[model samples]
Target: MSDLVDQLVAGALDRVTAWPDGALARSSPPPRSVLPGSFNPLHDGHLNLARVAEEMTGATVAFEISVTNVDKPPLAVGDVRTRLAQFAGRARVELTRAPTFVEKSRLLPGVTFVVGADTAERLVAARYYGDEARMIAALRDMADRGCRFLVAVRADGAGRVRSLADVAIPQGFARLFTPIPESRFRTDASSSAIRAGRRAAP
Candidate 1:
């Protein structure tokens, strides 16, 4: 099983792989919508967000886990299996090498990416891409691929709840983002906090 898992992760590094609920793995077509996350433990917050996203978009939401990372090392086989286990019997998932939305857009064009407010904030922040011009170019590339974002509410570092409205989207890219009203869904559960709690446990 571990050897198979290793192969799956290796293949995903080259192209997207789809794991359907209670089914086998295969190549992925462009999903209508995707909720990409690290899913360290696949908590309720993620499930609720996907539920709301599906209801709003009228499309089945597939979960995505990128084995590659921009700031950290790629996930090891054991780590990938642990995260993939949480989705078993619950949701379909896609494994890919895309570490950024721009890369993901190119792989799965015309898909709506379900994201939290914090992610949407970073998407438009010039610092993330080195400069405003680079940021704009990346966004233009995503838009050109017909990618859009569905932003959900999330609490910022200051404990203030933020939605898409709080994000400073660049002028021309406004249409690429849509907000999931706080009335529809909200969750305080965070994977970082969960991991911290586990580490603190005696």
Candidate 2:
């Protein structure tokens, strides 16, 4: 592992359990914008979005895979390897234990998280934070930590789509999120569809 991954992993181990192995770890500094996802079946859409995000943020774009998911089982070594292999020489990847954006912000400060429309909706949703007050508090903490979000629009399969502008973000925290115009990037490529056997194997 390179120093960058080594440093990230060492810091994360202090609070979370993780398993990572591959060439995705690099000696260079981690990216300010991280695109976190399951990457169940890596595809061109993922690469396209990362490329666009890097161009906009001028930060090294990293593909982050959280070993610990909120509703899914922890990823095993095999699962991590299979996914990392998909990256090849395309991008830098990281392993983390953070399952939610709030935790991810606390774990890595001064980061601009690039997420899809769905993830952004969930972030501001009260159910995820237990209540509106808790959600507001989390957003406040995230902003203080220099964490922000770049939300990409996502298609809802019913021929409808939602972008960052569509979601009602927390008051006073609106400055923390940036929206990617649909004209620049839009895709219906979702991991859920791939898992449902709708997408072909790469």
Candidate 3:
């Protein structure tokens, strides 16, 4: 790894710094809304989602990528560079070690998280947090931090379109989410499909 990448990785591990090309100066204001993703290979779907989110919230959307993940291995130095490159001249990005939204909320308080229906579903799943009670607690913490989610509609594996309404959000925490109507945006483009060579890059 180059000296800059090494420094960035260390910063993410130590202080949860936001790296937009270079370190985000301490004077920079925290982002208002962020679309956290693996990006794998950013496509038009991701771009359109950010654009619609910006219009809906009237906030400039920033992209976030966690160097470490719960389900996947930590990104190598080269992998991190490749993902960050996709955003060059396109959008602002923050590199982090926060693998979950709850952690991300702590790092970026009072931010709206832009996510798809599939991610919203996983966010509420009890399996991820060990039990329903713990899951509720996590949501409560995120809410307390003034974190909210702007969810977009996405197609399921069975080809059915799912919206925020389709997610089984905990009763009291339902207010944390707002749906982006299908009328406003929809896309079949997915990074996984593209990576698998099943679809062309958008």
**Residue-wise C-alpha lDDT for candidate 3, range 60-132, written one tens digit per residue:** 9999888888988877878987987787666778677788999989878899999999999999999999999
Q: What would the per-residue lDDT of candidate 1 be over residues 71-161, giving only the tens digit for each residue?
A: 9988987898788888887778877788999989988899999999999999999999999999999999999999999999999767889
lDDT of each: 0.87, 0.77, 0.84
TM-score of each: 0.92, 0.84, 0.89
Residue pairs clashing in model 1 are none
Instruction: Please give the lDDT score at residue 58 for candidate 2.
Output: 92
Give the per-residue lDDT of model 2 (tens digit) for 103-156. 888766788998888888888999988999999999998899899999898987
Kindly give the stretch of ten consecutive residues in candidate 3 with the minimal lDDT sum. Answer: 12-21
| TM accuracy, model 1 | 0.92
